[model samples]
Target: MALQIFNVLGREKQLFQPIEPGFVRMYVCGLTVYDYAHIGHAKNYIAFDVVVKYLRHSGYNVLYVQNITDVGHLRDDGTDPIIKKALRAQSAPMQIVEMYARSFFEDMDALGVIRPDISPRASAHIPEQIKMIQTLIRKGHAYEVNGSVYFDVTTDPDYGKLSNRRIDAQQAGSREEIRGEKRNPEDFALWKNAEPEHILRWDSPWGEGFPGWHIECSAMAKKYLGDTFDIHGGGIDNMFPHNESEIAQSECANDADYARFWMHVGSLTVDGMKMGKSLGNFVTIKDALKRYRPEVIRMFVQSAHYSSPIDYSDDAVQGVARGHERMMNAVRLTRRALATAPQTDDGNAILAAVEKARADFTAAMDDDFNTPLATAALQELTREVNALLNSGTTVGASVLKAIAETYDQLGGAVLGIIPATDDSAAGNASREAGLIELLIKLRSEARAAKNWKESDRLRDELAALGVILEDRADGTVWKVN
Candidate 1:
């Protein structure tokens, strides 16, 4: 099947034909960096990360750009997020931004999320933003009011086309109660005048102020990816006002389509409740990595399609942990058998089935990046390899190599849900290794002395620490669970 994406602009699935052959230019909205990145942030960013990974796997030279909003992200109550955070922490706005931005990258790195090719900070791109706002004003799509500039939505006939909001069909706002500077309530701020106490300000032609939250992405994306890119992605919540405004201002300023395809990931819920700071139910990536491994978290996120909402819980993550462990164990088993397999052909029929899973994986991912189905295909490969390995059948050398490649390429490279075979986690266990070795010695002594209770307790304690001990034919060998 041809690749298809559910573009929010069209509100239906459309073939994702690239603007240029064998190349994809993609942009995703990133964090405001006012607070710690939470599960909701993980949901959006991880989805986009998988998209970029799959595109590269499919032979697309993808240029991915994600913006960092260090300023001008106002809350629903018209309060600056960074300023409010600074007040609470007794720090400056830029200080808060720098602190959280570093922590955010650290968290993402722990989760194996690929860093974007270019991560432009809004505060650093004041000139580009001013140029875009100036272009809007010169084209009559925006007007300066006092010391601020607002997009003239009525000037663009297709203002709400992205969000499917018909301008004439909607009731007009009460113009009498003009609280803000905009002539129309639908007209959003392109650049707002910085208040006297505003910590972040830039000298724009309109006034000394920062870029709006929506304009930051447009400015940075255009600077890196050009006027019209292949895909623009973010959370579904962004489709209404934020993305809609992006479309309006960008198309008007550039006099071209903003993004060819709009892909929005679904929300993340915590135990059936929507994740929010006010609700106190959100899980941060820092907290998540402290318990579960990164691959397990990836498996948890990819269990469902990108468009589906996932609920987070300890039980759910534990189930994912078990599933990820099973896949890894199968890889380990197949590799061990391959090490000693004969060079001559054994004509094992299971190898053929395992190889076909490679095609299945490609097909699943090509169909709009159906990662859950792709993961299922990877599991099928694991199962076939394990079946042959466990059946005491030595597969041919070439077939063994094929199985290993499928596991590495599709499972490791494309899905990124499989940790590397030489991952440093094993090396990092030196201290634990010494502790585990001592315990193993004690357990051996207990078994030798016929202390059954003590031996069982030692084994049980190790198991609790995610170290499983198996009594082999010669002795016990421990592997991380």
Candidate 2:
């Protein structure tokens, strides 16, 4: 089956035909690097990582580019006082860019996300951004106000096409207050006039200032992937002003569509509330990694479809941990079964099951990269593999190899949840034992105080951490896996 993905533009799944046959060029908008990444950031990046992985596995040469936004993102809330804190902290703009850029890579690496082929920073492509802005000005799509350049929303008839918003229909002056020079409230900045205190300023034809957030993406994406690319991806939150403005600026300047497919992943929520720094309910990826294995975190993000909101909670993560372990157990059993199963030529049933699972998985993924369905298909295969083990069936060497290969291709190469066999398993066992003992002591005190939520939370967290606490009629006993 040909691979298909839901084009957000058309709001339906379409067969994926790359601009260049047999090759795919993809871009994902990356972090702004003002702070440590949260789980929401993880969901966006990991979802796209799986897409890139599956595309490559399906025999497409993929050139993936994810940008590092080390500059130009402003403090949306007016009260923060210090705008562009990241740029001002370092001795030079490049220092700030490299510092946060490296940290972003480190966090992504810990989450098992494969690094992109090219990670261009906004600061490095100033020339390209300036050139694009100049083109927009020459094309009469933009105008200069003092040192700042603003994209005239009135100039482009298709200004809000990406977000499906009409410029005239929008609430006037609802967003950031328009400067006196702006022609309309909907017009967005292409270049900002840096204040004397602005530390990240650059000398340009528009005078000393930095590129706007949307302009950086248009400039860098076109610089690397040309005027049009196969796929452009980001969080759904970017759909309105950020992505919509990108389409307007790029299309107005280049006289062509900006991208073929616009993919937007949904946000990650905490207890049904959106997770953001301003909300003060956000958990950093580093804090999450300290508790759960990186593979477990990746599985948690992939459990839901990319286009659907994923509610994050202790219970939700624990459920994912259980599911991930079940998958790993199947992998281990398959490996052991392969090692000892008798070699024969008559194991075609198992071979057929494996092939069927692969075909089903590919088909589900072809339908708009339905990861949730693809994940269910993997679970079904795991059940079948376990059932074959329990049935005491004799398997041929070729069939065993095929099963192992399929598991590795889907679980390891694409979904990226392969279990690691290492000395850390022993360490995990010791840690669980220690944690269980500590929790039991705490539970005793909680029970005496009638703190039900505390006791239950402690018990649930321990169980989710892979420590099973069995409460018998007589008493509670714990076991560490």
- In terms of lDDT, the best-performing candidate is 1
Backbone clashes in model 1? 0
For residues 430-454, write the lDDT of model 1, one tens digit per residue. Answer: 6767788789999999999999999
Error of 1 at 379 (Å): 2.0
What is candidate 2's lDDT per residue for 373-426, written digit by digit as tens?
887888888888777755656766667778778878887889888744422222
Q: How many residue pairs clash in each candidate?
A: 0, 1
Q: In candidate 2, residue 249 scores what lDDT?
A: 93
lDDT, each prediction: 0.83, 0.81
For residue 444, give model 2's deviation from the true position in Å.
35
- Superposed model 1: Cα runs more than 4 Å off: 422-465, 471-477
What shift in Å separates residue 139 of candidate 2 from its native position after superposition?
Answer: 0.9
Model 2: residues with Cα > 4 Å off, grouped in runs: 77-94, 169-179, 345-348, 420-481
Ten contiguous residues minimizing lDDT sum, candidate 1: 420-429
